[model samples]
Target chain A: LEGCAPCGELAQRLAFLAEVDRLKSVLRASLLCDGSRRENSAEHSWHLALYALVMAPHARPAVEIGRVIRMLLIHDLVEIDTGDVPIHAQNGAAHHGTAQLQAEAEAAERIFGLLPAPQGVELRALWAEFEANETPDAVFAKSLDRAQPVMQNIASGGGTWAEYRVTYAQLVERVGLRIERGAPTLWHWLSESAQVYFTARTGG
Target chain B: LEGCAPCGELAQRLAFLAEVDRLKSVLRASLLCDGSRRENSAEHSWHLALYALVMAPHARPAVEIGRVIRMLLIHDLVEIDTGDVPIHAQNGAAHHGTAQLQAEAEAAERIFGLLPAPQGVELRALWAEFEANETPDAVFAKSLDRAQPVMQNIASGGGTWAEYRVTYAQLVERVGLRIERGAPTLWHWLSESAQVYFTARTGG
Candidate 1:
């Protein structure tokens, strides 16, 4: 831990890395695209970041790709402590509980604060931006975040949707609308494809 | 795939995302710190990018961190096609061969080329930069990349190194030098700790 400073920056960074490794254990409700097992927050965040990078052109043409990537990568680090609350479980009144919001905000500070000062500050800001979902970058990142589980559900033949008894109406209202707002083209393709999947599965 | 496009950028980007998901199946020699299973290239790249962001202060202060993170994220993506080559296997004369390098370069092109034009060009440039390892950003990224496996090996009770018959001398020569070159303090700690580990195991 000794490096020219009393509390080494390297030590702080290593602590942060070790702490975030716990994120790999926090399982999400969605399955991996392969359906081998439930996906973890670490892998989910990684996929979202890659999605942001590859799909940068889809995010409002003026969006900063770097900011979107950063937002995607850090969006779920708070879940390292709060754990993932599956969207299907958060219908209407359940989604807006003040207690859940307060806990996640505190978790964000404690988790991101493990890094050295400047790095911690930067990441917390990015996390906050994504939480707000007001910026184009945040909206785009959220779009991918919402779309990914739907893609996994469809890929795995109704993996989460079937397991949770999630209705097509809920999927459309919760996930599809956000995708449309952020990346209209992606929403169009995804919504149509997802509808076909639900229809085939449910005989709607 | 249909949308208003000066080009079909969104479709191309989505295709690239689906293509890169194959990286999740492309396993590497390093085990997760938990020793559950071999880590995939996607998660490894994600960890390295997060490492670069959190540990940037530990790199030579002059390093451009944004570039280092980008390099870390895309560095092993070529493995999506070429497959991972364990470090222990690349000893002395076996390390350098025209065929291996040529195959990887081709793999890089085909994988990165999956993105839309401008993004693909940028990523290809980033992947090439990491391969060259001359820039400060590349060196920092390479340092993290090398150190990660060592940390995992140590954490998992000599996992891959023990499995592959990797000697202390080989680890020092191949990994230690790079760590020393990029982040001397980490090299000092890791080399000392790793020497103790090898000595205990081999009585050398």
Candidate 2:
């Protein structure tokens, strides 16, 4: 299989597929809205791609939605090696320290490297763009990444927020601003919804 | 949330998202290659999107890979209501009977309709195109749809093929031809791999 001509490329792609299948086991802290079980990174990535597709019209400065969807689909493949670092967890963003960033960069190289050279490079660059979150496409992709869990939390009666004790103000400071930067309209609605949920939960 | 201006559109999109989240609970006959548990439709859709991204170069007639990836992401959202009809199940293709097709059509309308009008119409059309499997894009998307589970079965030591007692010939007739039509290179390698797995399993 290894020495075969064209089949060698197919073998490499299959090897990459087999390795990434482990992503189904990398569970995130967020629960499904139905409260069934924690969601895995694979399904979370899928849902975010759907988010990009359905929510594209709302992205600020507009974007090439195809690029946004692709970014969402591959953005989290690194979690297959590094495991999910829940955003609501204590010092979660801070946890992506220099060491953690270095580990993720290595994981991205190895995982995407399993493809033939052209695709491996293309996808690795897309993943890097997502980590940078600077381009309009990447910014919207990043917004959906943050927006999904907030939707889940509100639907699941404060899902991770309840579990991790994430306060409304903290959520606004941490998650809201990021989503607002890319999709202000979404943050507008989500902030209203989040306020309603928190006010009801605390009877304030 | 329902009747308010502007926010009305956002509400509809969020409704659509919340509804489709049920897709994660729709289990498929295919197992994760790791053999940990059965795969769900959401993750399966995700992996197929990844397949489109990685395998686009092999698509005959070439394809707009973004549209192909989008098709893969939403192709199985209908399974949310119709439930997964496993390809290797006895009379599996036959089981996509008039009744099932009607159910899936209705499911697509009700689900996609939950989005704001433009996105809803656009997506519903894409879903129908994938179902029709006529265009070059549709052909390639459908090919990856079939190829993914075969890859899973082979990697998991004849995963579903062993469980369902599917023969190599049946696999060729049922799955291989569709793959070959859109991706000859992929079918060439998959058929060779499938033959090896079946032959070794039977010691023939």
**Where does candidate 2 clash, by residue pair?**
none
In model 1 chain A, the worst 10-residue window by lDDT is: A1-10
Q: Distance (Å) between predicted and true CA of B60, model 2?
A: 2.0
> How large is the i-RMS for each model, in angstroms?
2.0, 1.2
Q: Candidate 2: where are CA atoms >4 Å away?
A: A1-6, A91-94, B1-6, B91-94
lDDT of each: 0.79, 0.88
lDDT of 2 by residue, B27-47 (tens): 999999878789999999999
Candidate 1 is scored at a TM of 0.88
Best by TM-score: 2
For candidate 2, give the docking quality class from DockQ.
Answer: medium
TM-score of chain B of 1: 0.92
Candidate 1 residue-wise lDDT at B54? 72
As a TM-score, model 2 comes out at: 0.96
